[model samples]
Target: MNREFIEKLENNPVIAAVKDDKGLEKALKTECEIIFILYGDICNISDIVERIKSAGKVAMVHMDLIAGLGSGKDVAVDYIKNTVKADGIITTKGSLIERANQLGMYTVLRYFVIDSMALVNIEKQDRHGIAQPDVIEILPGIVQPKIIKKINSISKVPVIAGGLISDREDVMNALNNGVLAVSSTNEAVWEL
Candidate 1:
């Protein structure tokens, strides 16, 4: 993990998480504040890192989909440190956050809140075991203003709204509710 890159994202509010090479180009053209490259898509981590540096944008690796880490905590931590060179990590597990802190990497914990029950459970769990991350990516499934506020209330870390967000209104709704920024695979929202 690169401390400098993590600092860059913390400083910049908006970021674009691009899915492919095309999306990378689009994100660059859009002048997104930061760019996240999925670790699975990377055949050459060094090349990608160089491109990101050359473009003057913060680059992070998305390791949530990695085979081992997707299943459990131990493998997740191993892959997080060994498989990618990123400013930080994007994961859901509380254990991973703790491990990232140990590795001296910034953590971006993602929570998929499908309903109010899940939100409540997350808040409860957050209180006891998890160390606060540098950022939390909240995927509320449906972009509800109330849900956004609910997440904001419990989390001290900066909130980033993601998943199923389709337009500027949804983005505005998220931001209005206290999310520091938003992320999407959609190019339209990527421009925002």
Candidate 2:
């Protein structure tokens, strides 16, 4: 993991999550130090990453959302590392996290807490050494402070609250609950 990047997250917990070219441009103009790319195609991803880096911001790609990247984790990971040269990668697959780690790239494993079963699965995954991401991103961040607290207590890695973060209050709530950072697609929240 990049200690500097981690420190940056600590200093400014709001991460700009860009979903399109316009969003990317908007994110670069923000005070955010990190940007999570939730949109890109194989043809344009490298350019997008370059643009983010040129702006002196850390770029983290949501690997599963990229188009034309194919389904093979190894191939996508390798491309993101060697080609895009992104600061990190976000994914829901543990295997992808493991692969990205091996490649010397930062990894964020996204988990959707839709129900109680999902919470149990998170613990099970951690126990089995499958959830070994540098950071774990829990979705619907505002609605589950208790669950977030539970995960934070047991998780070895830092937790990032993401999804459904609509405003400054939501960001603050997540941070108050012990999340290392909050990823939001809402540009308005970027200012917070």
Candidate 3:
């Protein structure tokens, strides 16, 4: 799964983050090769997955905020693979990221540099393949450039930029930072 998607991502570096069915069509039309549904309600997710497949792009579901999964990382991983039938998983928990790899599912780990504490934590770790997620989705606070650079510096896997990235410049900044891609629910990015 990772091998196949890596080849695709090597060629096209952006993923259209779609929140609903309406955006799926636009994402497909705009040639966004990958998609991630940010929510994890199973009934809703099943429908979204169908839409993603119909649009002919890979569909991934975020498990961190998924409803009903306990705080335990293992439970979250199990819920996504067994109950959700997601093509892949997105999460912040390193344990879940490792488990997803073991399950042979594409995993994207979402990390943030928002608070001073988070920044401090980031500095302490050599993030290279720590959780071993197939992709690392970095939250670009106010400074999109810094986020891009951070992704390029430590991540061995592909980097995907998310959060506070609203326009073409942000997307371009992320790509310029050696990011394999950027994901946004904003329909505007799709048009770009």
Models, CA RMSD each? 3.3, 1.3, 2.8
- The lDDT values for all models are 0.68, 0.87, 0.70
In the range 1-192, model 2's lDDT, one tens digit per residue, is 557667888987999999988988899999999999999899999999999999999989999999986595688899899988998899988888888888888889888988887778778878888638888888887866788799888777788998999997898889998999999999999998
Which scores greater on TM-score, model 2 or model 3? 2
Total clashing pairs for each candidate: 0, 0, 0
In the range 147-175, model 3's lDDT, one tens digit per residue, is 55754665566667777668888777777
Per-residue lDDT of 152 in model 2: 88
Candidate 2 — which residues are off by over 4 angstroms?
Answer: none
Order of candidates by lDDT, top first?
2, 3, 1
| TM-score for each model | 0.80, 0.95, 0.82
Best by lDDT: 2
Distance from true position, residue 20, model 3, in Å?
Answer: 3.3
**What's the lDDT of the predicted structure labeled candidate 2?**
0.87
Question: Can you write out model 1's per-residue Cα lDDT over 14-60, one digit (the tens) per residue?
Answer: 67877767777788777676776665443565466557757776666
User: Which scores greater on lDDT, model 1 or model 3?
Assistant: 3
